[model samples]
Each structure stands twice: as structure tokens, then as C-alpha cells.
Target: MFSTSNTLLYADKLTDFNMPMPHIYACHLSDQLIQFTGPDKKSYLHGQITQDVNLLTNDALLWAGQCDAKGKLWSILRLFNFQDDYFAITSKDEIENALAEFKKYAVFAKVDIEQNKNHQLVGLFGDDLSAVLSELEIILPTENNSTIDFKFGKAIKLDNNRLILCIDKKAQLPSCITLLESEQKWQSLSILAGEPKLNNQAIAEYVPQMVNLQAIGGISFKKGCYKGQETVARMKFLGKNKRAMYILEANTNKPFEATEVEQQLGENWRRAGKLIQTSFDIDTNRAYALAIMPNDLALDTLLRTKQENPISIEIKPLPYSLIEE
Candidate 1:
């Protein structure tokens, strides 16, 4: 039942997805959605993730995190209700290990988890979605975290300029919607949005709060006894967590590679943070990235890469407040 969409031809041999106009673009999210069904789905998941499972409804999506025993995240994903069942959408790099660990913890639960290959997610972005909405003939989601039904499957509005589609793999996309073959734009926008997404190499490296997950409404303090709840609650109450996710940008002459962020401490640079994701915008000719660093670091702090050809980078403010309260 799960398969790739043959209807979507690769425009890979063509130009890039970044159009001259800023927002008018669409690309495959390239993310995977895991389906959950059964009578006990709610009760079972309520005790497993950082978000309260009882909050899930047809009208909205909730950002959630599944963590390890020590409170480090296994993955951070978007959870939603499509029709009769629930779906958890995550990046492709996270699918294998996250799925394995997820199933391991569900052995006694009545809920069933599956990789729903019948569906695929499309990233829709533009200042004006009215024209695109008419082409698809779907209801538009009005607010953040809102969900709306479409011909293919379901849609979730991430913000005013962005929404995502989870459609049937066999369905044909409307000609009005220009679907991009590459997901690089999706990667850059997500970095600018400051939504923390982790790859396999970066998993289990930090607690959820260290990545500003709680700041973005991805964590619930009132949720009862989920896995690693103790560690999570302690971080908030004791003010023990000192790290946060930050958006960084730099004008570069060419593509740059960096694994860690370094601060200008006195004259010598020292390791300050880990770079989680990076993307280059063809239009702006600049590189953008997401890095986890000290929560109290001054904004626009001078930083660079540990690489030999170090690039100068500065922190940019996230769209959402990093404040916990």
C-alpha cells in the first residue's frame, strides 16, 4: 500500500525550485508519515511523547518529540489526524532508527504503527495561496497548526507563508502547482523557521530543551508522565538547561561546509555549538544554518566554523521567542 508517486516526474534535470519571486514555490517535503490506528491509540501515545496525545484533532497538528530514557530526543515530528487515523511525519533520515525504537516501545500497546507509503508530503509556500488553493480545490487552513482537507489527502498550515500537503502517492498533482524535484529550499526555510529537525548522525545528542523545542511549543510541562518527563521537568524547574537552537546566516563566495560553530573567545576561537542543518539560497547567495548553542549567548554574536576556510557567521533571531515562560 505504501509506494512512491509515479505521477511526479523528476524536474531534477531542470532549473532550481527557488524562483525570482520569494514565496511562490512548491517542493516535495520528502518527509515520511507513520500511521497509527486502533482503539488505544490515544491512551498509548499520551504516555509516550512530549505532547499530549489527547490534544490531537482533525482541525490541527501538534509538534511532538519522542525521547530516550535520559531525555535526549530520538526524533521531533509533526503529529496529525488525517481521516480515521493519526500520522507522525518526520524527515527521511530519521525514519529507520526512529521507527525501530518506536515499535520497540509499542509491543504491549494496542496501537499499530506503519510507514504509510500511500501518502507523500508537498511543501507549499507563497504570500498568496488563493490561486494555488483554487487549482487544487481544497479548503485553506486559516491559522498556525490548522488542518484542511484536499482532494489528495490533508494539509497543515505552518504559518502565513507556508503549508504542507500529505497526498495519495498515486494521485496526480494539479498543473497549477509547480512541484520541485529538490528539497533544498525546504531545508533552508525550515532552518529560518527555527524548527529543529534532526538527522541520524545528530540523534540522541541533546535534551529537547537544548534545541529550543520547548520554546516552540513542542514540549508540554503539564503532560503527565511521558518518557523522560522527569528529566524534561527538571530542566524547566531547576533552570538547568543552558542551551538553545539558533538561526545563523553568512554571505559566502561558494558552498561552505561546517560541522561545529566556534565563538571568538578573546583572540582564539573555541567550539561553541553543533551545526544541525545547513542550506544555501541561490537568490540571496548566502548560507543559512541551524545550530544549538548557549541560551544566554548574545544575539548577533560573532561566530565561525572550526574549518580551515572558516566562514564568518552571525546569529539571526528566530521567528518564535526562545523564552520558556
Candidate 2:
């Protein structure tokens, strides 16, 4: 739970942003792009992350997960190529852990990996996004998992209403765009879109499928071996997975945090499972979350926070389906 103490200001700025039309909105993402340079960048990353590095190109972005040997994730990432360097955008807090895992085996590979402080990630959404980009003489990557380079940044289209922009920290944002101070709106969109927002709290907490990464095309089942590939493969082919990430939201008067959700079992509540990520909206006095629970959890079932004063949240339909293509 976080607050910027600008409820009125948020409403004023985003009034049109929330309209049915696609009015543009921007916010700085609490994420960074790690640059992997050197001759073996592609081949090295190919064996390190879940997605096929060969499939990533200047024209496309790919969702990927870097996992530990047991198939537990270090961080889920969006990988792309911008110029000569291959970049992976992930939560800032997990960078060190992810780096430690990546470097252990890289001693024998030809890639040099480090955070690129020169750029910062940003999120864009709302009114006529493509038209707004065109006004600034920039091309929007219209397809999901697609990429395009513009004068100000490398844009990755997450969907019609959302995108992740990697922009130079020193560059001037076009005057046409308004940058919001708080990231709540941006984060809420990602939560609703079913994109798991991992922090240090989430490290090694789940395998990719537990967070619905495979459902989103983040896993490459047909690709050759990578770190943790054995367990990931076994879970899929052997039907060993019984849990998955799901969307949840509820109105709240004050900020609250919880690790688990409780389900009503007759006269009392029983601990269900853990909460992976959460975002609090001060404006609406509501909380949005991504929780990991048994995949068979009934859609009609409601869950309450595992706290003295519990807030109940019902399941929301994900924009995409859980079944993979």
C-alpha cells in the first residue's frame, strides 16, 4: 500500500484518461532495463532465460522468466534488442538476485551484463495511443509483444491500452504527453492485465506457471535446455502444477498488507494461499492484487485478507485465458 497524497490531482489529470476513448497517459515505471553486451549476447541469454533469445528481434519484444535451478523464478522479464545491446526489463529490486544467478554460468559465456542507468522504463496507456504517437512522429508498436524504435525511446506494446517505454533518462519527453507522479494507475493496469509485478518479496516464490507466465507465452516449452528447464518441462508435461495466479480487488478505507488470503470454511476462515503483488488506489479507496492459489479455486468463491480486519475481494476475469496455445 502506497500513497502520494494527491487524490484530487489524480482525478483532475486522469479524468479523461479513464474515458472509453484512448486518451494518452504516462508514468515512470519502477523498473530498469539491464543491458547485455558482447558477441555472445543472444546465445548466452538464450540458455539463461525462458524465452527463445533467437525469437527476440528489433521488431518484437518477448516475455521471459529467469529462474533458479529448481525452476523457481528470479524475475519475470520483458526481453528485447535495442541496437547492439540486448536489454531485459525487470523489477529493480530483483536485479541483484537475477544478476547473481545470471553471472554464475556466464563466466564461460561471452556476454557482459549490467544495469543500463542511461535509460528508464515508462508506462503509457489511454486515449488513441497510436494516434498520439503518430502526432509526435513516432511509430507505436501496435501488436502485443511487438517493438519499435522512436526518437525518444524503444516502445514495447503490452496491449492496446498499455505499453512499456524504455526512454533515455536525459531526453525531453514530448510536450504532448503528461507524466504522472504516482504509478498506481499504471500498476493497476498491469494487475488487471494479469502481468505479475514481482519485487524482492517474490524471489524464488514461484515457478513461471504458478504466476501464469506460461499462459502469457513467457515460457518456451519447445526450446532446448536452459537453467530450470527440466522442472518447468516436468510440471507442464506431467501435470504437476496445481496452483496459479489470479486477479483480485476490494474497496478499503486504509492501506493494508497481507501474505495470505483466507477462505470461509463453514463457520470460520481457513488460510488459502499467498498474495504475490498488490496495488492500493487512494482515490477509490480500493486495493487490487494478484494472488497465487490452487488452479481449481472456484470462480464464484470470494477471498478475504488474512488479517484481523479483513477486506474481501472477488475474482476478476483475466483478459487472456489460462490455457496456452
Candidate 3:
């Protein structure tokens, strides 16, 4: 278990981030784990989510979303299977709300839903992830989203370069693994990776496509009869979606919270989109934000903040292409 003293020690190490490669950090502060177990678990989830739940394997994790009848996202999460049950990792603030939403539909199903606080979510990043895990005698799934049982925990490969380690809260971390102090670094990394997550304020404000969920493998158009399936399917087939997620960077003295994104229309600034998530590197004075904006908007469209002191936005390339597949 990571104790109070351990946390302090980890915080101290964060001061000198120039440490050697193969970094590991506690990510539980920003994320929470929700578990679903029952005979009807798969079928129940398959009917309520946008991803094809039936395709989820014990070895892989799935990115999915739960949306309302109109297809607005309620929560976007990482789903995986462990110990004969299904577990989802989502923003901590949305855990209870998501649980409540899950229960509303799970009432008739045999599934049991509950928060699992016993596990701590940790992020492992660096080129030496495989080597470091090998040193700890941990074997992880090689394929992206795949998972494997490790010592008293589970290891999931979010991608080739990043892994999410879910360890028992009581388990002591290996000496080589260094815990990150601030979540800003992790958040920054996620933005660079173009992974869009939802917070309390942004819930029910975006459809999956608006956030580019389909481009990120979070949506499955072929899946049958999930909540909001009809609307989502129509958008997919009709290609009428006018908004999409984009990465924007700005020079700011401090981090910017989620807010409205505006485009300059001649002499006037008009509402063009909404900022979904952001991370600011204090040292660099650069703010990175993910916003949903008009897809057809010209690349030269001048975008700025809608607040009193507006910041200019510069478009940045996402790791993946936004073109619909």
C-alpha cells in the first residue's frame, strides 16, 4: 500500500524531474475505478454503451462512451476485464455520477456496480517500459489495450509508449518506479496524445463525433442498439457532423480552465466551440487545450478566448488523423 509517508517521498522526488528514464507515477488522484460484475454484465453494457462491448477480451482494454438518448456523452471511459468482471476507469469527479447513471439502467440487469477504491491507478511512461516491467518481473499484454496479471495488480498497455498500472493500494511500488508529483504532466501528456476525457461541467454537452471519439476508436457504428445509437448512427451515415475536436495551444501566464472557444468574425468574435480539457506547463508558459470546433471552419480562422483577456489559439496536430474511417 502507498502510505502517507510514501506519498510525501514521491512528492519530494517530483522536484527533480530530471530523473532517469522509465518513470512511474500515481494517477489515482485524477482517476477512479468502477467495477461491474454479474451474469448479465456484458449484455447489459452492450446495450447501453457506444463501443461493441461484446468484442472486449480479457486481454485488452476498450475505450467507450455512455451517452444519453440524444447521443450526448455522459462519460467517456477506459473499459477492461479483470477477475471475471468488467471494470472502467474514468475521471474521479464523474465516478459517482456515472455509477448513478449505470444503476438507472442496470436495475433490471443482474450486474452489481460499485467503486473499487482498493486499487491505485498508476501511469508508466518512457521508452523503457518493457525493460522496467521485466525488471519487476511483471508481464503485460503486448497489444495496445491488452492487459495482463502482474504482482497483486493488473497492467494495461494504453499504447506502445504508455501503460496504466492498477496496483493494490497496499502494494509497495518497486524502487525503480518513480511517482510523479503533479497531475499536470500526465494531463499534458494526454493532451499531446489527443485522448479526450470528460469532466463534471462538460458532461452531456458533446456528442461522440464532436469530441472525435470515432477517430480515437471510442465509437462503434456497427454495434447494435445502445443508448443514443440511433442518433449516433445517423450522424455516421449521414456525415452531417459539423463539429470536431481539435488541439489548441496558447501562450498564457497560467493554466486556462474549460471555457468557450471563439472565432474572430471580421471585427466581432463569435462563439465557435467549447474547450473540453486543458493542461498548462508552468515552466513553459504554454497552455494546451482540446476543444470542439466547427469542422468546416477554415484553418486560418482566427480563434481566441471568449473571456475578458483573450488568448490567441494556434492549431496543433493530433497524433492521429481526424478523417472518418
TM-score for each candidate, following the candidate numbering: 0.91, 0.92, 0.90
Q: Which one wins by TM-score: 2 or 3?
A: 2
Find the candidate with the highest lDDT and give its number. Answer: 2
User: What global local distance difference test value does model 1 have?
Assistant: 0.79
For candidate 1, give the lDDT of residue 224: 88
Q: Candidate 2 at residue 96, lDDT? A: 83
lDDT of 1 at 68: 84
- Write the residue-wise lDDT of candidate 2 on 81-147 in tens digits: 8987899888878788888888887789888988888888878777567665775566665578798
Sorted on TM-score, best first, the list reads 2, 1, 3
RMSD after CA superposition, every candidate: 3.6, 3.5, 3.1
Candidate 2 RMSD to the correct structure: 3.5
**Clashing residue pairs in candidate 2, if any?**
22-126, 22-127, 22-128, 23-126, 23-127
Model 1 C-alpha lDDT per residue in residues 1-325, reported as the tens digit of each score: 2222332433332233344333245777778988888887888778878998778888878988888888988888899998878899987887777788778878798989889987788887765777767777877756788888777789888887688888887766655555665677677778888888886667888788987888777888886898788899999999889888899988886545878889998888888998887887665577888888898899867899778889999798888886756
After aligning candidate 1 to the native by TM-score, how far in Å is the CA of 246 from where it should be?
0.2
Give the 10-residue window scoring lowest on summed lDDT in candidate 3: 8-17
- TM-score-better candidate, 1 vs 2: 2
Best by TM-score: 2
- Report the CA-based lDDT of candidate 3 relative to the real structure: 0.78
Best-to-worst order by lDDT is 2, 1, 3
